[model samples]
Structures are given as C-alpha cells and as structure tokens.
Target: MFADRAHAAPARQDPSLGSTDDPERGDVPGWVLITLMTAGLVVLIWALAGPALTNLFEQAIARVSGL
Candidate 1:
C-alpha cells in the first residue's frame, strides 16, 4: 500500500539544476561594508570631538570635587 503512494509522488528537481543566482551570495560582503562604514564614522566623529568631550568631562569632575 505505501509503495504505490511513494511511486506516485512527483520527483523533486535538484537544487544544482535550478537558477544560477545564489540565495546567500554577497550576504557577508554587505555586512562587512556596513560594519566598516560604521566603524569609520565612529572614528571620524571621535577624532573631531574627542578633545572637547574630554575637557567637558574633566571640568564636570573638577566642579563636583570642588563642591
């Protein structure tokens, strides 16, 4: 009984026989580009504002300690 049903089932096409476009292509490169861009922006912002931020923090600390 089971054998008849199994033979009646349609054959599935092999994945290698399908479209040339890959489902997972470029996934890593896209993430790497995004991560690199974010890192570069963070570095640029830090470089531009690092001294000012440090001075502000030091002033705030001095005021608190003086009080």
Candidate 2:
C-alpha cells in the first residue's frame, strides 16, 4: 500500500507557544496590558508622591508670602 500524506501532521508548531490554534487563550493583547500597567503605575506614583509634592508647593507659597 502507498503511504498516506493525508494523515500527516502540520509542518511547524512553536515550542515557546504550544499552539496558535486558540488565539484568545494564551496571550493578553499588547495595548490592553500597556494601558493597565500605565494606569497602575500612575496610581502608585500618585499615591506615594502626591502629598509630598503638595506640601512642597505649600511651603514655597508660604515662603513667598513671608508667612
């Protein structure tokens, strides 16, 4: 009997990514991840540094006013 090419596997599948068949399952969309990380970092920096900045500004204003 002749060999059957019909039952043969596909030529390539990436090992780093197991399969690309399910596009939705494995990876987060780049824009969505970047937006989330940017928002989180903004909130973190604001929370940590906002009060200090405000106090510094108030001190500068007080010094300017000679009070």
Q: Which predicted model would earn the best lDDT?
A: 1
**Residue-by-residue lDDT tens digits, candidate 1, 1-67:** 9989887967776987764467856577889999999999999999999999999999999999995
Please list all clashing residue pairs in model 1, or write none if there are none: none
Score candidate 1 by lDDT: 0.88
- Off-target runs (Cα >4 Å) in candidate 2 are 1-28
Q: All candidates' lDDT scores? A: 0.88, 0.86
Instruction: State residue 54's C-alpha deviation in candidate 1, in Å.
Output: 0.3
- For each candidate in turn, the TM-score is 0.61, 0.54
Clashes of each: 0, 0
Root-mean-square deviation per candidate: 9.6, 7.6
